[model samples]
Target: MGKNYFEDLFEKAFVYIHYDENVESCIFRASCWLKEANELYSSSQWMSSYILYLRVFKLVYIIPQRFRISKNASYYNDLLQIQKNTIQLTERLTTLQKRIAVMHAFTPIELSHVLQLANHHDPSTIFLNIYAHNSSKEYSFSSGTVFLDASFIQNNSLDAIRTVIKTPHQAHIKTAICYSCDNMLDDANIASKIYLSLLAMGITPRFLDLNSPAKVGKNTISISPVGLTNLGNSCYMNSILQCCFACSPFVSLFIDGQALRSLNQNNPLGTGGKLTTAFTSLSHQVRALQGQGVCSPKDFLANVCSIYSEFDTASQHDAQEFLNFFLDSLHEDLNSSAGKAPLPELTTEQQAAKERLPMSHLANIEWNIYKRRNSSPIADLFFGQLASQIKCLTCQRTSTTFAPFSSLALPIKDTTTSCTLETCISAFSMQEVLQGNNAWHCPKCDVPRDAKKTMSVSRLPSVLIFQLKRFRMIGTTHRKIETSLEFKKRISSGMIVPPSFQSSIYYEPVDYELFAFVNHYGDLENGHYTATVFHNYDWYYCDDAIVQPVTDFKRIYQNFSTAYILFYQKVDAAN
Candidate 1:
């Protein structure tokens, strides 16, 4: 027989009897005996080979009779093949069986005793032989076969089996089965009784794929992130909400009751805290049933539409624009500075002197002034400062001003087929010469002159948002850019610092790790939005009410042309 004859036979048997625990166990035992019979035949041990072949025949024959397998069943054909092969071998070995039995000391009585002892042996010591064709290594039963114990099968410990199958780097495992089987031949009547009991309970066997996601039990609560239901063309809203939920600090503000307490109900700019209450309620609903089910954000959507009537219709809107408006609404609703007196305005000379101060000092002073009027959790979390400098070409005068931004909108170069996030950041900070109608009115030159404008990061936020400018307005229609953009899992502060501030000693080193990102498919007229978020040490793709584990990170990040908005959270430099 060929070396792979039994392997191929068992593979077919497994496909047919996969769902039945009793039949699968019977086939597994038959395959072991057939392999031994073939080895004995190869060694010219006719007596031993005949006895093993009889055992294989009995195992296969009982599967059909004991389980009442019908002719229409898939495994019935494989069982007939087993019986035919066994009968042919028996006929050939019959003449030599008596002659070899007298010459050899391996009697059937002695083999029966050995089988009885093996059946009584401890199951913990039994191990399956796993062959990895790619690695050319055999994994002992400890790594992937621990769940094959009779206790595990009886107790229906599918979670334990799932955990072992999900162990990292086990995808190369080709075959795993017990090398020894003794219980089948020890006491046939007792074994049949046990198989019948298992069938009565409706407990079936399960095959595992090492690369597959963990299966959720009927009664088990899911640990995966919950998905949001899309109400009409609300994918833009759903995608941004998922990204925000992935941010621990941002979600904690609502989940921990901070947002409720900080609600500025009296402020005319807010919804009398109604929007905040609706958002907090939605956050709680998502937290309670994450991974377990999907949540309907209808009430939250109503609150949002109440504030922005443009989102009332079932039409697609820009996700970046939605995110900006959502954050602004939340900031206003929870703004602590609401109803507070406004700060005194600064004089023109005072403002000019403040700008003339060191870049670091000017950034801090401006940030403090901005915070005096816009104190909120949103401002503290997502807000960052940018310094814009306009230098006159005719006169050597540089005017610098600092402004706060919720998100950095980076322009993508249409000339390039592919680019990196660092390249986009560089392009955003690079100097641009304003000319013709776009010329800057230089105060020092007292004329509209061609000047150089440069923008740079003056202050970093706890959460940094990047919106890639992929849509362009050409004539009356908006065209989408399909340039592939590659981004890193972690970015250093050096990549974001402006060229002018690279040597500044006051700048502190920081690192940002990507937590979530939103992707847009199709064109501006008919696009779908989705979000890939990192939650609980794994990445998941969320598209409205559908959520699935992300096994291939490369497909989502590297050279991904659909990535529209990315969310990065601040991390310690030491990390």
Candidate 2:
């Protein structure tokens, strides 16, 4: 029902990344190779696999030299590196990826860390890299890696009217064609653009500006997060992480998906401790919201607002715990030579909107909660400045508060590899029983002449996140009880329920039937620059309460298209 077409593309990426089918043989052969080499003295050595591994090392040398920011460099270079790193690392694993040999038991914390890394891999990194590239030229991802600036976007990509226009205002934002991704026009961003175009037409009998409480507009801007407004407290972090999880249901490598599959070899449990805490908080609040005796729609609205107020307050409270971390991350950059310029207070209307909320308690809790924020290398990367470090929440080991802190993310970042399934199996499977058969010498796996064991090869499973761009909540304008199902049935039915490792669960479906965003462009932030669109760069995830669909890399552009058209033609992408 949601972006079914992206399945093919996701499979392609998975196959390329995991190098499925023969990974087991490779592990086995490496194990055998080392065993044989050790068994034979210096007088008799079989270094064929080791020699072949050295050949893989050549791949490492070859890539960084060819790393250029040129035409079509991202997908290919990234894919190639992913492949090369897999070969190199797999060859190095002491267990050779054998399930029997690899340890079956792992501590919860240990499991959490590995799952976190496995889920938070390069695809997200690559997607963010491209986003930073499009928003501003000054912000490079490599620099972001070094600097940790989360706010940087390429400012210059939009400065000139560099693109060749096919038509003028005739092409509404909803149905714009992007040459990227082979010009697939049937996308969520395109759908949202159509809806946006309807609004822009002024032909509709009803339309109004969201900025005004009365709803009036000659022009309208979708007030999400962008520009100067930091969603008070750690709402920014919570909201973004929530959006990522909501958008990417196919994501099994994450902590939540531990219910579905074990992505980490060592970890039986999934990701960080965040999901459990967040879910517990959300559940309790939702239950209390339902208990209110409703007299009318006003009562219902009152209830919702109450729940939202409390939820956000709680969220902010949790966020404050990390303020020391966030602040430490930014302080160094704030003091840097480049940062000596007056650091402008980035503000937008949302902050002002917070002032109008009816709940005084929530208002008090909002900004006061995350009053302290430090810098990260990521933040510095965005701002072209250096940030200070914070304490590691996991180890409590104090070094620099930086994310790449020695005690925090150990072993740091590593490369990955990929190759054709057939080629990998064929090249590596060349061994026979040590006693007697004519074999070229199996470099991937070796079996004892008489060992008793059973083996099974199932689909090596993994996932990529894809976002649903046109998806929207249905009842925000009117506080109506939209569902007919009872609460028990809803829970049991897995309706909008986040899936677990063993359970095949789903959450509330995107209210796609009621909304559509057909448009000339789709960008993540839902902005427009007077009708200028950046094609492939349009779909970037914008964080707030509204959930999106499709985090898959292929469909991210659709988000770009929606955001591009809305921002450029209606609002302001530059803002």
Candidate 3:
């Protein structure tokens, strides 16, 4: 019998599976490779080809490295052969495109893996030979395979999920993006680069910001170059499923071995300005990705090696190290600083670049700190007493202590008196989310008439800012407020620093008679400015956050932490 579809492409892969010792292993790898290869043949895009190459390349490189096997020479040799085949196929297709004659370029080297039949350039050879041949159809959650639904994936949440999925135990899922232009049209440059990289990994790469997507609704982001209908049943098609991959030090795939090398060699992070900030932020994000459950550190390294195989191993190592260091920052907010040990003395490196090094400080910040929920009926958890005000009893005994949502590690003042957030809420918000006309109200806490703070804490939120030169994130999530990838061009695109509208980049007072009267009267008319109608009155109110009881301490704790992390990080970083 002839070899299978995948086996034909990788002739020497028999040893990878140890057909002589473990037939099942060999068959499984062969089956996987076969399915992957056929998927490549069925597509005309290079994106899929790149992915397929990485998929096969990983295992091909791994076996030789770990086992010191003789498969090294053969694997590269096989790659050369496949490259040769690909070139020949391209030539054939090109010829067919021009010629008005019948032709056959794909040689029938193996039978259908599913039907035990010969090839005919149809789905039979591709699908049957690989996917169908593998009889195992059922999937368990615990299974190693990451069956990511590609259609409805949220382009915005891609980075978050990438981080979560890489949480040591999870498998890498293929994300899909818009196969449109290279978003290099100016402000779209950065976003375009992100999408292009995602294309190779199957992440959603599109040029649209999908806010408020629903499970079933009419909200479809018209950003797809190929239209949504072509996405079929893939979860990535739904507008509600977009996960943005606009990476900063605080976003995207972290712990990339290759990235570490490049960052150290060429771009030593934390130089100030936008470029340095972006790289440092990117490192943090990639590190967080490593913490996710989707992809493992090993897998990430392997993928890097395969796709960026041309780079020297040392460069790759630097890239990975840098990636890990940046990710380490995201392990928790680089700020917050809950621990109580004094910071170590500055090292030589730290001292040499003391000015260049990042510093932590508490700046202009407003928070809505709340007590732990006294009761949570929804999750079936309960609490007794909830403190109304935050306390730090040890303040009297400890030295002058400060908690300014720091970037570097610092010790808490003292153990006896903790700086814990008490019962009341102290929430802050972004201006972007405040643009809507209707005021968000919550019956339990704040309606339009209730506490303004509560109303401002909850409701519709802005995750990121839409700027050209820089991307800012909402709250402090230690992530970007708005996805830079949403835009196509970079600084050149004018989106970051769009053409200045001389009319109002700052404040715009409402039209009122009070202003007219003020002009008629003297400066401050009499003792105080007379109010005709209180013309410059503030009218906007944010969404209300109804404080519920904390039934589950852990859940509520995590929720609080998530919010606090972002809030303080933003506040401190800004300072």
Candidate 4:
């Protein structure tokens, strides 16, 4: 059968296999169970999912034990009987129950008590044993796998107190009412108090189903929203902010107020106070969501309006342009006076000696003492180096210069034909002839001669940003390049950097995953800006305040939409 068939059977709880089955057969069963557990987890069925998850663990335990025992014998033959003695099924059940209890942070005694009274408990509360292995070699079991690493409950268990009390609408309401009544509160005060408690825990109260009654404290809304109040014609800014929030390293810095605290140093841009505060506040609001749901950037927009007067206007602007300006402003604010500290006073003899030098000599002396430092956090995180190689054809002499780039502005070669992101990138780094007025001035030849020039990456950043030059000046009118471009989920450093240029640098090959991208829907003059950002391990399409969870990969990779800017984060080595 196909994987889907097995998955459907497991999801319906129709698959049944005896515990005494062969090791391979048991493994297949476990795989099916694991799949269902994952599906349930995705749907927020925490309690039932954990029960199935434990069953898989119980089944997989046979693998290690089978290896430890005699290979010639079956797993059941080796572990089930000891000295021709049959191990009771109840004994195996007790062991599994203990492990499950530990995984759920419940006492074995309490679990046994609950298991006996299954009819009395709710459907979700009936956590029962699903599997029991034939293993006689008694070993301690704990949640030792790397799975569920992203769980809010870090101990590889559900919060029993919260799960038991907050699950099912009626029970939740009872708990809320009891707490209020215990405080000697009135009926009028109970609703407000309960609402505040849920809000304090970052939970939104919503109906479990569309047809469900609107009882405030009855149901728990697993997802909370960070409502983004859309400023007029500010979808570009909203999209950028959402994508940036998804960047772990970028978000972590400001989320916990570290970036704000570090801003005590010299500001690069003198008028960056509003921008800095806005971004920091944005981070704080997102972090407050606790990786549960969306957040609004009202404060961020307010701050942006205070600084950039153009953004305050009700006009659609380029996302790439805003990103560049934002990064530059941030860099200036954080590191402006980094290496520009006041110079020490010169002695009378030193001053006299300096006055004797020519103006060109004076300029050279000042340049020698100039210290270079990191521009800003944005540059430090996303900035990369590009080496421009210019070779004079006549003299056969070559020269190289390295410059910093926040993002690559790759020009689309043919507007008529379809292109991939790789093609645009290749065109960008491809060697081209610089002839006539565009010739290079060769120092050795001391003349403006025709030369071959190429650009290649010298240093790769942790985050790679790409700006596709879609709009171009055709004759006198500006037109958009209507080329269908394709991009991959994961791209390697080797794909972009040239082999010859890469050798001299400490070029560690990195795999970057496409996380966020801005899409311009429409022609050059008139288009709406939207963004697709990866949040909580899923792709979300954000068009200002209206955000939708995206499942179709094609929606993210639509070539018709003008993919103005792309963000890629280096894949974790551990993953």
Candidate 5:
């Protein structure tokens, strides 16, 4: 037989599986790796099985050391030995499973013994192998092989099934029969007798036929670099999904296995529930994919349209707008706050006085208090604080107010050639004299006065998202800025500090590295959105469902004119 597609990969994994020794803190990851190994082994994918087994072997050995309880050190040591022995036994049995893959010549007694041993280890665990071969048909099984569908299994009946050895019941017998396979060499009379005995024991067997080939190969191509099927005009949702999931923290949240449970436990209503569902599916899909995988945001788009009627139309919408709504929905569900609370009620006179008070004064108090009280996981990680300092030229008094922002909106300079990202950031934090109608109302002066108004980064987020102000309204006509922008791999917080605060660089300087990009192609009225993300140290461009690997970031993105949003992660924070 010719070598299988995964044959070479399997050999590499087998070496690691046999000899691996490393320790890590996360026990959940070890457990998940073991589960993946077992599942792959059962599915007859030896290459995936080999890879996952090695992962489990390394992770399982580390579990004992991960425990910090000094008193239970010996106990953990003993537990490790038990697990090691179990894995060794499993590894030996894996060899047997491979040998039995094309076991047409096996006798009834040998077949029965193999099935009994496999089932003996764990009743719930399934170890599958092809029984016979027929050149004419694609799928061929033994004459009396019982096929079991997953839906037929019930949670309540699990106890009866688990107690098969000590207290065999109808459930146990049926489950075992469903998991069994019998060859043509087995006596028909004996098979009939076995069937009769099972019937006498109140166990009835159900079967579903299989049509797939016996010695099947993996779908290495079709499964990955997945193309998403567009549902109407869902490119907006698609683009957002690509960038969000590609984020390392976001991917870790799901793979570590807490985010889904949190979302499911606190199942919010309407769009929240649907968004949760979509994330749940996305998380699983991301984990399950071996390489680059295809994704579709049809469900996510449907949920968005249901909540916001404007999205129901096929017309394109702003990606940033959709991102805000998506994050807000997630925040409502995943935020640290127990739930949303109404603003405190004020007396008639107090409300009137509040309206009279300068908006910045109220914002300095209420907004800051509110932000501290309701710090969400998303907000805590992604929200940056902006300080608006208004210095009264009349009294030499300065008023500093803060507001939380998810992304920084920077204005692009009208340059023919290329503009640097640093320059755009510098322009954002530039100080301006607010005179005329735009004058600041200083409470110290009790009147509108000319003031130096400057906005600077008070606090930086782990992930910094920058949105370029590309769409400009020019007398009922929206125009797109075609100014080419070039971004470096690393940038300092000094670039975003106001010119007046240039001395601030002497203090601790925050360093941010490029992590993701949202590129807008075409014009303002009609444009397509795509994302280029850095994941697992490689760059991949995701356009809707189609994902293609990119080698050189500078070659593709350097001086790109259509860049809309650039995502950066703090080097220290990312670490």
Candidate 6:
């Protein structure tokens, strides 16, 4: 077949499928084509099966557009089934092509081309056949074809292939396997180098045990905790960076190269994605170190300083302030709604209706409005809504406003020598009287009057951060609160959300697990910051260039007086 054979076939199929045809007739034709395609697939006729599948998909695509089939209709399901079969068959054909290209006689450049094509689409699985080679004899080591995740191979093609090729052999034995193309000598030497380098770097690929037939190749790479080399007085930045890296979901987006797609270079509020690019490069370097050595964040710091001039100096800063700016900058860089028009203002009637809606619905509406302007992974994971209600003393009317917050700042009472986190949260959500200069201007009564203000968490983020207000100005002197604040490893949303808004706002019970926290020592003016993070089911204290495992929770709990910022991640309800 010619190189353009599939393209030509698809074009002709589209031309033949009548868009004006009846919905039932088109569905029937698609169903028949799908049946034949499945048969051809079963018989291993990939080319013919893919052709029929493409044609069926083309027919099914126009059914809804031309006839507008109702989703509840019986034929709608049939059309859906046909479309699913076609999609599955298309993926199978693509995988088959990749396998054939890999197994056949091909050069390094040819294999690279095949891999490039395979990278465009995601395949469910790929098979690797491993054989053991020794001085005496050579034989198949794997019982059968070994299954591997196609995405893993797509990302780390050479490393994955090397791992699979070296899985069954002992370290002392020199093995040569012709897994790809006819250039066995060159490929084998390359694979050997990769395997040795991987071992030296402490990245052992996970593979199925030969004794376990049902197990599949996971290709899991272990990441070690690599310390950051601090540039003078950069402990505050380093501590926050360590905590951000501890976030699996946030770091994976950069480590896996998925954040690049969402990078908004055109955003005026952002650093033209320069910060995100620098951060991604830093993440790669951190992973490459594999805990064997320290990684310098000079490049990332340079990028940060270019945007925010305050961090350019060699002076210690507040970790919480840096964290807020860092998250906000990343959010702007990756904001999906960058340069997009804001949502129109709601009509008066709509506003009244919105006020009448339930708290959940109102929160969703507010969130949608916020997302239209500030949509990003950072917002999705770290942002939550705070509801503030103000009751007018004169008019006896109340108004509620919803605002977004990245972190909750809780105030510590000076009278308490020892306090619990719940007490702080309750203090944060409690109501207060507003009078004198803080009196509210009543819009309905047209006068300034004393009012009562209440605050509550209306929405919860997947990851939550709490900043303890330890530093306060006491009569023009900066003083630090040395009160011990005790907290648990896990906390429920009920502790943060008010009792009145619990059932109405959150339908399901939400829980948060403490993963990381920043601690400050010494006075507020000249303090050192260190972070303790939970990674891989173990706790580690990260102090700038030093990373150490913490086995004793009692010792860590005793030093809670210096804890400044707490990080929590929402537990998956399904898990």
Q: What lDDT score belongs to each candidate, Candidate 1 first?
A: 0.66, 0.24, 0.23, 0.55, 0.56, 0.67
lDDT of 4 by residue, 1-575 (tens): 13363243233221223333445555555656666756654653443454455455544554555545455665545343321221222343343333222222211122222222343443322121111232311211211101111112222223432342243443233212111111111122222333344334344322111111221222121122233556777777776776676676776656556567656344545344567777777666665675455566666776777777778637777778788888767766665346466668777567646544432233334433432545556666888777676788997766655567789999876566667778888989889999999999986699999999988776677889998888888898777776767767788776787654332212334568888888887765567787778764478777776777878878776722457888998863212
Model 5 has an lDDT value of 0.56
- Which stretches of model 6 miss by more than 4 angstroms? 1-223, 346-353, 504-506
Query: Using TM-score as the measure, what is the rank order of every candidate, best first?
Result: 6, 1, 4, 5, 2, 3
The residue ranges of model 5 lying beyond 4 angstroms of the native Cα positions read 1-226, 263-273, 338-371, 497-508, 552-554, 558-561, 573-575
Residue-wise C-alpha lDDT for candidate 1, range 278-321, written one tens digit per residue: 88898889988847789999999998888778986478898998
Against the true structure, candidate 6 reaches a TM-score of 0.62
lDDT, model 2: 0.24
With candidate 2 superimposed using the best TM-score fit, by how many Å does residue 372's alpha carbon deviate from the native? 39
List the candidates ranked by lDDT, beginning with the highest. Answer: 6, 1, 5, 4, 2, 3
Clashes of each: 0, 119, 113, 6, 2, 0
Overlapping backbone residue pairs in candidate 1 total 0
The candidate that achieves the highest lDDT relative to the unseen native structure: 6
Q: Tens digits of per-residue lDDT for model 6 on 1-575?
A: 24564465455333133323456666766776777767765654444455566667766666666675688887777777777776666566565444323222221112222233235431321223233333212322223334333333434656555565444423533222223222222233333443353445344422222221112221122345678887988889988988888887788778877678899888899888888899999988888986667888999999999999899647788899899888888899999888878777777566646655545456767877788899898888999999887888877666678999999999987765788889889889888999999999876677888999988898889899999998999897889888888757888776686544442312234568898899999886678989988876688888888998889987578655568999999863211
**Reference-based lDDT, residue 475, model 3:** 72
Choose the strongest candidate by TM-score: 6
Write candidate 5's Cα lDDT for 1-575 as tens digits. 13462353233232111112223223434555556656656754443455556545544554545444454554556456547654674654456334333221121122333343454553432222223334322222333233322222222244333233223223443322322233321233323333333445565422211211222221111112244556766677677767776666655555565455565334352244566566766656755675555555566566667777787637888888887787767665665554556567777566546544333234445555667445556666687667787888998666665778889999998768788888888899888999999998987788999999888775667788889998889899888888998756777665664323321211224568887778888876588888777764477777776778788766456524467888887753111
TM-score of each: 0.60, 0.17, 0.17, 0.56, 0.54, 0.62
RMSD of each: 26.7, 29.7, 29.6, 19.5, 20.0, 16.0
lDDT of 6 at 375: 86
Model 3 is weakest, by summed lDDT over 10 consecutive residues, at 511-520
Candidate 2, residue 191: the lDDT equals 24
Candidate 6 collision pairs: none
Better of 2 and 6 by TM-score: 6
